[model samples]
Target: MDMRETPGVTPPHPAPDVFGHVGYQLKRAHAALRAAMDQALRAHGLTVPQYSCLEVLAARPGMSNADLARATFVSRQSMNVVLRGLQDAGLLTRPATVETGRARPATLTGEGRRRLRAAQEAVYAIEARLVRAVHEDRLPALLADLDRMARALSD
Candidate 1:
């Protein structure tokens, strides 16, 4: 089956030579990598977002719900879902937010820290493999380029 020129079923459109198209390809690549990372995290009973929240909380303890949502680039509703799951698992606790009485701060418990450590190790192992697959000389420039692309698209 020729995917690029599929038949009567209506083929997918090819990306034009444009920045948006290029960014889409980059995003697709990142999504694939994230899927692999998620698989790696599964053994620790952590989803990708859960692990991300743990990472963020570990680094910035007592982060407000909104701040965590922004840090993880998710909506507050989504953050609540993930936080709820983690809380149910006895991994984290939500306390009153200092800045906003209406919001709560998310903090990792000892159990969450332990699981996060294991998950972080798992993620690093997979990430190391992925990094090794990249060309050595291109890594720095590629990261810088990705940062620029992300900033441009986000703004």
Candidate 2:
């Protein structure tokens, strides 16, 4: 006899099919975006994390390593290595010593801004392609929905 057919029994909801699940779709989109970014950034000699760090620092100068790591979605340790590399490349600078706190603020040098500007052209082109894939009228709604979904899960 079917459990649902029994008067005293209750059946649990069936799991969603993986292929049609929202999470699966999101993962596929993310993978495609990552691959595209990787290829585009390669010509500029920048990794996704490195590019992200530069972008964030440009808008908010003097961000500490921890804050930059969080903004770039990388670990603190990984951000340290990235900072060191940028420092060596003359793309950014940090004080030799900190008197008040252990957190060292990072600022992009002139070369860093130039590099970021070049990379931004490639990144923005990719973003434009993505935006074109969606309907013009529905783009705003789609962005809002995506933000809402992220906030729901984060909360």
Per-residue lDDT for 1-155 in model 2, tens only?
75335577433434344565577778999899999999999999889989999999999999999999999989999999999988898889999889998998999999999999999999999999999999999999999999998899989
TM-scores of the candidates in the order shown: 0.80, 0.87
Q: What local lDDT does model 2 show for residue 66?
A: 97
Off by over 4 Å in 1: 1-21, 96-100
Instruction: In candidate 2, list every pair of residues with a backbone clash.
Output: none
Backbone clashes in model 1, listed as residue pairs = none
Candidate 2 minimal-lDDT segment of 10 residues: 9-18
Name the regions of candidate 2 deviating beyond 4 angstroms: 1-16
List the global CA lDDT of all models: 0.84, 0.91
Best of the candidates, lDDT: 2
Error of 1 at 44 (Å): 1.1
